[model samples]
Target: MTAHEDPDEDIPTGLDAAVTVKVAGVDQQRRHAELVKEIDDAQEAYYGRDKPFITDALYDELMLELQKLEAEYPSLRTPDSPTQRVGAPQEETDFSPLTHPSQMLSLDDVFSIDELKEWMTRTEAALGHTPEWLCEVKIDGLAIDLQYVNGRLQTAATRGDGRVGENITPNARTIKAIPQRLRPDPAQDFLALFEARGEVFVPLKEFAAYNDKLADQGKPQFANPRNAAAGSLRQKDPRVTAQRPLSSICHGLGVADGLAVTRQSDAYAVMKAWGLPISPYNKVVHSLDEVLDFITYYGQHRHDLIHQIDGIVVKVDSFAEQQQLGVTSRAPRWAIAFKYPPEEVNTRLLDIRVKVGRTGRVTPYGVMEPVQVAGSVVSSATLHNAYEVERKGVLIGDMVVLRKAGDVIPEIVGPVVEMRTGAERPFVMPTHCPSCGTKLASEKESDKDIRCPNSKSCPAQLRERLFSLAARSAFDIEALGYQGADAILRAGVLDNEAQLFNLTPEQLVTVPFYTRGATPRELKEPALVPPPGIRDGRVLSANGRRLLENLRTARHQPLWRVLVALSIRHVGPTAARALAARFGSMDAIRAAGVEELADTDGVGLIIAEAVRDWFTVDWHLEILNAWAADGVSMADEKSARPAQTLRGLTVVVTGSLQDFTRDSAKAAITDRGGKAAGSVSRHTDYVVVGENAGSKQARAEQLGVPMLDEAQFRELLEHGPTPASETPASETPAPETPAPETSAPTTRASGAPGTPPETRDRRS
Candidate 1:
């Protein structure tokens, strides 16, 4: 019998024995030893190693032949048959229960290129016109559903049995690419909430590295990346899942609310605009021919990619058309998977090397003899970290099995242990930083990494700093980018931050926007001078400049942005804002003792120390002084105006009020003469609580702070600002008098404290 025949009828008494079966064409061995070995070997390679023993075309052919043999001889079919299962069962773990918004479904298979072409022809015939197709890589990993509410991440779940799934919210949050908040745009209303579905998986190389680490730890290693990722995701403890390297790309929508999207491409664009992580490889094609072209292109270039993708998924672009086409009990009729053949190749490991990032984190990489995987020749693959090298027991000159998983990302699956010649050399991590000549310092808290502590002087750090300063979010000098910065640095025109502002237009043009455009014969050089009517575009017009200059002449500006621009260690925008609001001004913050700074709300010892260290630095102090000399304000200019009305009186404002936010009302109080404090306390002179006032108003009553309704407060604000001489002293008391039994303290409660007892009583 052929190796593809089913072997289930006659039970083999021994492992090497064959069983007999009858097919339509002939009687054959039901359990051929060679066929079983081939199946086992292929499974081990495909599932355990992420490397296929044969191409998809060959594998599918064998599977089809086996199925045909089993169909004819039903008695020969076994429960262990590969065709009987969709995927391997999950390993035991603690996972939360989840219900899918919509049912998950599997796609029907199309075996050959001929079959794919035929399916396309039939689809076109039914649709009338050649419907546009969106070609996307079919990611090989666990499918998941993500839900967002009011632009905030709410929950995430895994796909299980196409109907229900397991909740995996916490695990999903660790992915940096998936934004927690949707960024708004002026042109479109941000989606308030929506459900998006995608696949999450570790890249093949990352999976190997992960497994290698586990092996080094003397823990059981997963056979393949997909299995490992699936197992990791199902862990009851989300922290464990978070530690695993995982990434996702949204390819489909589950549910959407308060938003209208017509086309699939538009949906992708909207998702990206909202800061959702969508696949960058999606393409909208005009016809089936274009779809085929994309498939060919991806197949030919897959090895250079990072993630694992099995095939191309083509779908009708228009939502309406998709609806018209409808769906089967399983998959959508408008969509079909155009899979590529699997790629597995043999290559030799020449050496393994470690590379360092800007952050000084060391990562291991492999250098190998060039071998074709998918359609490209690959010479190297990432080994991830030091832990991976020791775990895999990989060595130089080892004969290894390599693969292009999901037709992307070349990976070294394992060594051919039986063929080891004992000539392989062990790999070790470098003792010094690769980018800089500094000694590497291993992390004290974790053995996962070693870093270079010389951040200020590191060449990599300097390059990153220059790039960050010129980024769109920072100073936004569009003409200056990576290439421009590098050229300027090479020319020694910019060695430090202060030198950037000194660059003249003459010096700038000489740096060259384009070498061809500046060639001597091509264009005549003109006498260098600053552009007419512009010394620097940053300067405002005469009147505006005068106003700005006057504002800068004052002591302060809003402190948040100034702190953010400093780029202190471990301090981001949010932390900077919090620090600025608490500290008030740069001078006040700098003058405060370290203990006092640390005692401020939200300012811990670490942050306080950082702040102190920053001020202590001579260069930092010089920069700040120079900025001050150049008329840059570092305190809140708006808060420094003369006290107008309630100056010295502390008040707390709360709840929804007419025509004003709480902040504006508080500003109004400060603008008039009062100090607006956030919380109600015994020291507060008044609590201005509006409609829908809640616990704060109750707390004010309990604390005996005087409370005011919106109208009364407005009246007091409007008429209370007059000079004391305008009021005539009387035995009867003023219109703004407090009630006799109120008991709450008012401005006039402490008679003779400021105004005389008789005058206070008259005012009251």
Candidate 2:
């Protein structure tokens, strides 16, 4: 069991006779047997060995189910069951053991907001009154108990089975955060014996850097910070632990004699005075509302902190109240951990499948048993390429770790090796394209990405390109989505996107899927009949008409948008805009040499080469000619420029703006000749912050750069910044505080249409 695996906490609510369950039958008995075997195997792997075969979420779910079964049928309860033990016994024979002075316990964990509220309410009722709560970040790290005798350090141990633990005093001494001797006051007598409880961890940034270093050295990297810290501290040689930059934060007390502290917060202050590390984020809250606020604040800013925190630990502040509430068999009744939704989860890898992208590059993705993670349900994750699949060591039918951070794409971290059964089979990359039978080969000699060389005629590639053309960043065609693109190609309406604008209602009516109240699948049904309101034998659907309308409107959508729709490799909006600004016309861009194209600002050598090569392809140029013949504008018309009020200034806009889309916001700044930078720096003149504006806002504050809200940003856009002498000091916003209308943003690169700014190009 991991740190948060105490049975008292792991059991889901209403499993304790509050809700009725069907009586256990043969099916329940078989399920109970399966659950016990799985839970026992997981605990043995995690505690007995140091490898975890399953995620904390999976383990909790198993435990919940097991407890529910046991609750429903008392006959199934066994003394050797996982729920009956504090933790699996320590099996590390190399390390000497030491019995702890007192039992070190795990805190009860609550997952949802309602569960947290219920725990708080139950605690208040038991205490007879509301007690002050001490809230602190529950760091995701290994728990340790440091024993001190007569103001001097003695021994340090892990919380192995609570009563006894592995002796790691030599390795513990290597950590600078652990004080060797207590700083006693001359005016008062210090406790002769004291036990300091803390969580040992590695800083998030340092851990990432260290992982990179390890990868560079051709060494296997640790999976996470918690695992890194645990492995670093458990080294047989103390010098090995010394080499690792392990840090710790003291949180609770184990055993203290003659301590005069009346509250947990006071104990932390006393511990800090004694040179013990305590969390800077620890706070004393007088009410449940304040506790909830603290949780909410940390939940939003969890990534901004130095270390990883999985949850918030809320404890009864007063020692008297805590003592009265006392302890459960495995955890302290006075404290509970409000766990956030998991960012990483374990699920069965059902199969590995390959997908062909617009460029014909083949990427493998894992099909998983759908699991909820990071506030969403994800069933598939991209593996990038064949090499990535091999490197991750994931086999079909194995349980794999899936991670999704906020709104980012979900990815399979790696496979759990210990859980692999003999039935698992390694994935083999296909030699031929799945959609169109074309032999796959690397685009360049050194390129790891394999592609179908038949890019022009490959149905998969053409379909993907059509979808890209209709994306928001390209033609912004809403009606011609994936389904429409696939339907058009399958119905032989168009062989490729070259004839996208040539589509007519008469041609669309022939494709049953595009006709009113008729589907391609149902068209073959002999008894199937079309819905009412048909003009002739068939009529174009609303979506079909809308597609034609959108296609017409897309014809004049600026020269840059056309460049984006052409599917030129590396020629995204940023490079397209640069080319448009310099060349002005498609004819000039086609006639320009690679050196001239590369000379354009923001258009690098790679993008220039892609553009020069694209014009050389006879088929690519044929599409351009076809679109131009269909009345699509190939050149941008000259127009008067906006007032250059912000000519020399560089501004960064972050978060969602009510009046502007991400691209429109950038246009607003660039129209006035101001530089719209993605990231914040000391050179940034202003940072326009909007709703949910994340890390860019934080970086602006760190660099002491001024921030403006949507309203102030409008003022700045209309007229340049007011001089210091002209503006009143009282009216100015402090560098620390963003404007009242906007909250701080995160490090998330870019958001959806009404979301944050881009750290990278806002490409489809």
Candidate 3:
């Protein structure tokens, strides 16, 4: 009988109409069974193998449909139904036999803040003490198990189905942060077999860059960094993995034969020292108050950090305590991941406004009634692109769900369809630039990213350009902040970025002052400093004279600084540096062919086109040339002699150095052709550890890597390169130490190379 027909409608006797209907019901049942099998297979491939062919939304929809079918037809439900469980069965593995001494388990998810708080309360009640919580960034990436045998690297495996994992030792070794060998610690005699569990992830900026490069080369891009990292690690060739910016941070420890650590913090320190990257933001809090404070702090400042963190992992500090706490069937009892709820708020979409950015990209922003979300009052949220607006079906005067994903920026998640009234108006992407009234154009083959054809003379674009020029990293112009620039703009004295040079003391005297939270007030005319080679009745001191000189000289600042100051979309400080380093001069860069520009390392087609488009505008070229003509110095004349002693070596400096500040210590490494990385690794040739050095020193010992005290580090500097044979053994003699009280001189030479004179003066 067909599945749609009632089973009791007819008996299979002598050619009756009801019997034929029942036969139709039987056919429908067979079709439903086939669909269930198909879905189950797909689920197995996705969750079990970590290789999903279908989109998450599609998979979810299919599973929901399957669930509904099973509910409707109880007899169709099977033991292996997708709706019955959280994950699929583990795939068979062929790797060498290895057993986890302490079984690694998955986390039990608590979706909301209230749930997390409840979990904490329950744990405290069970323990009979306020457990010290160590909060760490919950990185959304691939989990890997690293095993170190006798202080040496042995194996690395993917967390496949909790019980077993795919062996990825070669790929793991290519990750520069992972240690190849453990430092020898005489104090810890039992640490022979050590296992560290962590997530491997790509930083957001690097991932974006990688995707951009892929697009430029006409290759498909991954959806997100997590997927990118996973795919890269799973590649058969280790060399491919090395090219990706895959980094790992140890969040928990597993079985260790040689280690005698009693606490989670000690394990973290050991992991960090051994050169496996541990989260820099990891903190140990003795009280629940401190734990909440850390969560709040990280939640607010999440965007500023490099990597993407979805939530914080809070774990019990004591290993013995953790052992006693033990595990449930699925998750560890000692720990729980405290997830910050998705930053989404229900708000009425009042209106839609189009904004033209500095790069002339037209973005649709939603004007909303003020709503408090994640401790901030947000009045507006970004619509991202025309496609997003249409996909979300966002409409004017509609109640919409606004979200700030990763705390990056507020964006309209979707419109609330259930609450929609007939008054809601559909939004259409604009055909003209909102700022300059130029025609908006879209690249037909690419995603819908609307752009203004007016490359220059846009008021909004110019304001951003000027702001970029006056930013702290660019010109070190203390007087020209956002408010100051706005005041300048409001005075009706300046129309473009170039008009700033034409301003006089009389013009400046008319500028208004607006205190942060107060009404605007007329400034009590402070005595002004005249520009260089121009004198007015402005009272000037030595410092004032210096400031004016610096301001005039800023016009000729380095090409890289100028590029950064322009605030091009998708271009950051690192990209600007790469551009400047390659081109050497602005004129050469502007004149270069598009393909040639694209061929430059780190400069993709999009950025290359952006650079070309920026320079194509006559006014932009005129302004740059005007600055050059007005005596801005764009080149560095002095070059430091290369120190061959430290070439290609990675060094870590910890604690206070005798002859240098932290910055200077880093500079010393750079000046000597070595990289001063923040953490220790097997690749690290030396660790310049100072007095009161804690975690890093311990790690260096565990890896059997040689550590240098401040005096020994200084000796290495003075004596030139130490040969492999001449290199001190692990038990080398200590050197003469300097007095702790002696403060090092803050000389100009000690400053960071290429730092502007204005910044150096401010530091002094």
Candidate 4:
């Protein structure tokens, strides 16, 4: 069996016994030996041959299990335990092995927020107080240490076995991002002999382009960007390595002479001044809440960055604090990596099938072998139109690459063509709609998607509309999921969403899917019983009762949600909000000309035309009229508006706030008669900066726009900005919030309060 195979599979006595049967002494020794062999083999395959048969996650799990065993039985622990190693040992390769001046340790990982808090609590107890935390994106790339002598680059090597590594100086020099000579700083104390630790990576876009080039040349493509970077840097020929676009960013220092920085953030600034590449996303914060906010922000925006990131590495900023909590056998005690859920995995493409959406657009999606990624098991992902399938070169029965970034919809990246068998078949778009037997044709000659053109009566279209109506952005009916919508439609209970709010409890009882026996399945399973609303010895299922209740609650939703529930093409929440804010009622919107609707700030010509076209449809108007007749909201109620404290001002809110979500913050600004802008510019009156604020905060500072923290923002919302005449001539006309007490832990950067310090870098 390969090193990647499960250890239980290799166990002689079978799987269950290997786990459940507790063993001690000789048996523990045997199990320890088996784990060690398996882990060592995996390490060799991963580091030496660059053939990681198992995932990085699986490798970590195996190593963790081994550590637990050794901890329980001390005799099993050995000097050569895989847990004691930083990375795999280098085997005989073309490159010469070079020993690092200082051991290159890896980081301990915390998988959950609770675990991270535990680490912080322990750290705070150890130091007698909480230390300033430096947060940085953990770049998923190959680690390299660059040596410099007298400000000139000397050699570069990979992290082999912590103490020793393979020299790849020639390949490292090819990365243009890496500086060959440090810039001279006359006033600064420069380190004469130092080693900078950084990651060598292939940017996401460049990696895609390189993979496309390889595909055109009929060469095998790399699995992921991390692997691509490793493969590129480890090339035997430097010229071959140079062909791929490689980038580098220094996040840390390994060993140094004459270093003068007191904090990690300051060291990064020094590195930046010396012409070394450092990440712009690094941040320094005082509290655990701020750290969590930073993690949350990056977790949501990981893919938006240039390079891939597996997690966020948080370290104590102060050099003294880091020293007090020193290194372990394999990782630093001062730092821990908070890993985001895995985003990509390889799975088999079972088949490609077409789905008819609410607008009658037929979309092709791949049904794949179920694989867990991004905290969920995704069995299928959208392939979009038929052309997308062909463009991605994915075939039925091919092992394909699937990706799910955070909460975004899962999608098929492409097929693993190298693993395809001859039996794999290309997909063909259906000539007719499977739902209604209507001939499929594109609305426009140039359009890639084919539609059913039976939107009014197609079962598939009606079901999708019902599902869309219940979405959180629309009516937010809690019990009406895709399956619920399908069940109601299949049972003929909901012809369309017009009858959604009119669903009677009596009519629902006939639909067997929504009714159950009055008794619970068993006395022990009392939770399965429905609420006390039984009739005729039968009861509505919990979800059925919930659906009815939710429908009643949904009727009071705002005019914008009502508009979104109407299924107008191109009329999403933004456009709907603009239209509702402009016209106020359904009648006004229906009466408005396309030009008049298009004149609204956020509603463009396309959305305006779509809204107008939707109003003209007889069935669509009937659905709207029926819903209105059923007491569904058709107009936004005119309530007393808040005081226009920020009237005529443009404000921008970025990052997470302690008291408000992004939408809520924007709503607070707009409700008080201020224009909430997304990007900062010269016209921006104020930018409310929060924890983990990105480039917009910098842009605000560049243009001399006033900035406010959460407390200041609250003050501004209650009372207008301080008048220019009343404000001191030397200070900007912004709210003045009192600073945190000196005795309290400093919340700002490493230096003086109110003066921001430079951010640091992190490795995956």
Candidate 5:
């Protein structure tokens, strides 16, 4: 008879109280089976469907409960439990173990900066010097060792606990990136046999597309890129693996026969010569500071990468140095993984507060207990709008999961509903605006967002508008951020976005921003600062003067920027550029009607209606007239270089520079008909790096991509790409490079009489 034969039994002591309650009427052994079933169902939904019914927090809790139950009642434990496995589900397999010539050891992982620094300190002690480190992006995918025998591909095996790995050679051959034969290189050691280690992964951009295909075929989709790659590579049939998108990045070695490489860098060089794929994000640095810089850079730009990386592997660059550092029982001491802050974390939702945007669009976000996510402390996250808040079913006092990917804004994913104590209450959006107390209005019953109609009077709206005007994507104005904009709006020195043109240094100093709602997100500013940041009674601070000059210097901004500054609904930088290019000036765009403007390329019906409505608004007209009266010219200007110089090219701009701000540098690239990308990729044409340049620069260096300093970048702007001896550009393109969506051209009608007839040229 089974231990679960009894219908009723005492509750397990080691299990969570909640779990005990969940299995109240069931027997103890039966409860263990129930827990397993529930956890497996959640995992299937998460991994197989790619659409999870429960949040990760809830899943983790359930998993914990199952583990506890199994631990306390060993008789109830089952071998088929989810906790006992790592790989995806199998159909049929003749899989057998393959012994490696040398152990495919794992690197010890360190989570925090302190721990990573401690590892570095210990490593330095071991070497009696700060050894040069080879930093490689730790791909979030299955590790594999590829064996090359007699200059031909022999076998591929998984990294199973560093000893014997499962042979998956047939499935590996399906990956196009894994070279079938090694390229002959005279410079490389004449090795007849060797094994190179690498990661097999599904690119992030392709992961979504692949998921869509699976969904269309009525098959469950994989949760993440890593899952997709692993599941695909483990298929019983090689043809199935081939049908799935899989890529490889060879990094290091496991075993070699008659090899004479002395340095890790040299080995990588030989690998590259032998036509093996390598990560462009890996580099060698002499100092620990540079290694940290690489980590920091990747942390900020991880989202920009096509493949996912949980952390970076810092390995001793010299084989001799690696030998001196030695290895532990399960891991190598010469290498350590400095993990990036996890993008997702668990925290308590204390409250939800509404944030009024520039257009009077109010969004309620959760006020979370401060938690570290993505290397930064996040106290609040956007719940989108009131409708979204209700849909997610999150409530106050609920333990919730939050996520912040790369440099993206932190967001509340959802609540751990199972952990709820019933004290949690559903949030209700107030009928009136939080900032101005104006009656809220929603255009339609289906509308997810509620807006404040009193756009002219709301302090929050005005402040946000000013901030938007100076935002990097809009105007490229330096030193005019939200804080400075809020200061000006609060002091009444800036009544409209256009008043920026008329502001004086004397008038600017009195700007005061009274903390409106006092949400926890506002950590830097105090409740009431009469003069912006000033604590003491002062009319004009020195810091305030510098801001005033920046505002003054913003007068010469281009027409496209002016259009963006106007903050027309549905009109962003791309739309503004299209409008400006088509009309040649703001006057023409303003004079055109909704019907005529709708005909313009890239100017759809929605944008056309928004622009027409904005022009017709009494307050908007007043602001435009004010700017015109202030002699803020609406003239269209042309760049010195031909617009097609960088046409169809993608560029990455990074770090602080003496000559140009981050925005201006990006603007320079865009104005020349190039795409200013946030991250580095195989398709990137140039990486313009400045002082304190982050991971993109390091990645570019690793990929052998062309890099231009400020001077060289300016030179390129003047005379175009030089020869290899002068400027070296990488020829290699990345796997699964995303082809940008191509919008078909629509011929535009010439707007109202007296408008410029020239067609717009906003390609990207």
Candidate 6:
């Protein structure tokens, strides 16, 4: 009040103007300071703590905003802007620390394929040509540098800050996959000194078994595999670390005898000879198309692998080219990590839903807000069973973490109880079946799942069983998903899934979907297609017509697939394929006794007995006969060959071939009826030799086995080992129209020209 009364006296008019002008400039400086502080905090959380407080999207947004502001107001910017630097300094550790020869940088990640292309374009522009690319699965684990002196392991250290790291040599020695010594090769060996860089990880099975042990002891389970690996490797006691199932895979060198390596492709071979483990999935491709194809295949089949991977890392294969491109402040200009969509995310658990399975198990599932994980949007995730539901403390209305385990099914990892509000409610397990109202009970004392008493008669069980039979790995009737399968069951189109072969579009167009209460719901409405429930009336439309078309398409499915679709316990695609390949026809397989079936290549006693029992069932036999009568493909249709030229002979391959990959060479041998043995023995018929051929060649000479050069190999292939016309087989029929005579073109591993698109996509 005193200042207001004397305002005119207190402020000179010219001073007031100056003070007002300073405010905008001061505010800009203040905002710039705030931005730097926030960015530093985020980097600290991500790099030092390994616990990111913000989503990647949010962090990227802040970085972009900071960059834009700095560009517009250059004077307000400082050298400390996150855009101008790498990660924060590494956290403190108790182990001995050593500085690296060069900074161990992290690769900048691009989440989308288009951004990946943009990174490639930038590299090409810098280097003045398209560089050869080498793609490897970006192993999701801790990075470590291993030093060697004259072929003996010296020290192993974890990548701490890029420049300095903690020594963990004692613990590293326990990993069997990482060699404590190397074999020196004159041409490629680091004769005096070298440093190898690679990843340390826990194999998936080992991690799972360790977690099981923890669960048995009433300890908290690991949230994810990566954490489990890191925690295992950094144990206080080296003996404890030794007990943990840890392994390593060498990627390439950090520094090699002070000489530049020629190519990254050669680096892998060098590491392999150094007694380090190499992943079979590694591939060297000539073009971007091939690289993309490799990534695509792995993306679809990551679950089939024994370990986990988050994405693929693409590098310029040439060491010279990489030097030309050089390094950035944070990452190399020649390499980029193309990250896959994350498999884990947090979403609100809106409610709980129960599902009845084909085996009558009543399982709980979480209905959640839609979230994208592993390339698909997931709206619901399995809670496994009632006991698990309670053990995870997954309350309805609480936020929960979801992950697509092995890129297969979505499942709840656990609940984020800290974020929960009082509005959240507890889940109550149902004592009766949700479908038929029958009482449920656990199958065994050790079992957590509650099973329904109603078995075959329950509509839910019937629908689920039919759906399983028609899964993509089975008959592959894509149009008949869960909703379509359930709808057809409720509509009484057929009593069992085997009757699906009898369906026609005419019958389907006339059959309307029925409500749970037996009320007729017309199938003509477009909105009813792919609906979730009968009461919900989601997808009860003319979808039946579309499904009928899909069902008809399934008739041509392979006999192995049909066998898998039969719902025989213990007999999946792999076992069924073994059966089909051995017997050649479904009829032959059905007539075989359990012992005979068990004799097949991949079939075990359990699977063989299950197959035999399934075929012996009267109802199953009737359904199979009816399906055959309805024109289903009941026999193996793969084009058959009588026998290859080199049948009944054994061959050994020595050294590396110019035109064939290791796998391709083996395949070629097997294709021609020769057993490809890794070593030459007295029984070996021939030894194919290449440059630098060594021990195998010496053994072959000692044993007096015939040797063949590349040109001679082709000459022998054209005429066949003993002329294919003389080959004999009792059952197999020779091709009516044989393929045009051609030289054994360089094996597929050689990246031969004119490879079909599908084959090229395999890259293996």
Kindly provide the TM-score of model 5 when superposed on the true structure, using C-alpha atoms.
Answer: 0.56
lDDT of 6 by residue, 487-586 (tens): 7776777777667788754445434552222234533443443433333323234445456667778888777778878777677766775576567688
Ranked by TM-score, top first:
2, 4, 5, 6, 3, 1
Q: What is the number of backbone collisions in each predicted candidate, taken in the order shown?
A: 13, 6, 30, 0, 0, 7
Off by over 4 Å in 6: 1-99, 146-157, 164-170, 173-195, 212-220, 252-257, 260-285, 293-306, 341-352, 387-407, 412-428, 443-448, 455-459, 462-764
Model 6: ten consecutive residues of lowest lDDT: 734-743
Q: What TM-score, over all chains together, does every model reach? A: 0.38, 0.77, 0.47, 0.68, 0.56, 0.53
lDDT of 4 by residue, 398-513 (tens): 99888898788999988777797699998999999999999999988999989999898899998899899899879999888998888888778777777777889877876667
Higher-TM-score candidate among 1 and 3?
3
Residue range with the least summed lDDT across 10 consecutive positions in model 3: 738-747
> CA lDDT of each candidate?
0.59, 0.76, 0.63, 0.76, 0.69, 0.67
Model 5 residue 112 lDDT?
Answer: 83
- Off-target runs (Cα >4 Å) in candidate 5 are 1-106, 109-135, 142-202, 210-306, 316-325, 341-346, 385-401, 413-432, 436-449, 470-561, 573-585, 594-605, 627-662, 665-764
Candidate 6: residue 475 Cα off by (Å)? 9.7
What local lDDT does model 4 show for residue 52?
44
Off by over 4 Å in 2: 1-94, 127-130, 184-189, 286-289, 512-539, 581-583, 640-649, 655-667, 670-678, 691-695, 719-764
Please provide, for model 3 over 1-764, each residue's C-alpha lDDT reduced to its tens digit, 9 standing for 90 to 100.
12211222222445554554464477656766676666645543332222345555666677677777766755454323444332221222224334554567998777667777888888888888887777776887899888877665667788877767877766676664465555444555436678889988886667877888876776655656777889888877665676777766677878875466778888776665454556555667776666676676666556534466677888888887887888988899888887666466689999998887767778899999998766578998888788767766778999987766654688776677779879999888888877778888874557578887666667767666666677755665656766666666776757776666555554554454311111122123322223321223223334333434457767756566677776665565545655665666776787898798887655689888878877777887777776666565554333423344565567788656778888667656654545677766677778777754534554455455677777677766665446532354366433322211101121221111111222221001
Which candidate, 2 or 6, has the higher lDDT?
Answer: 2
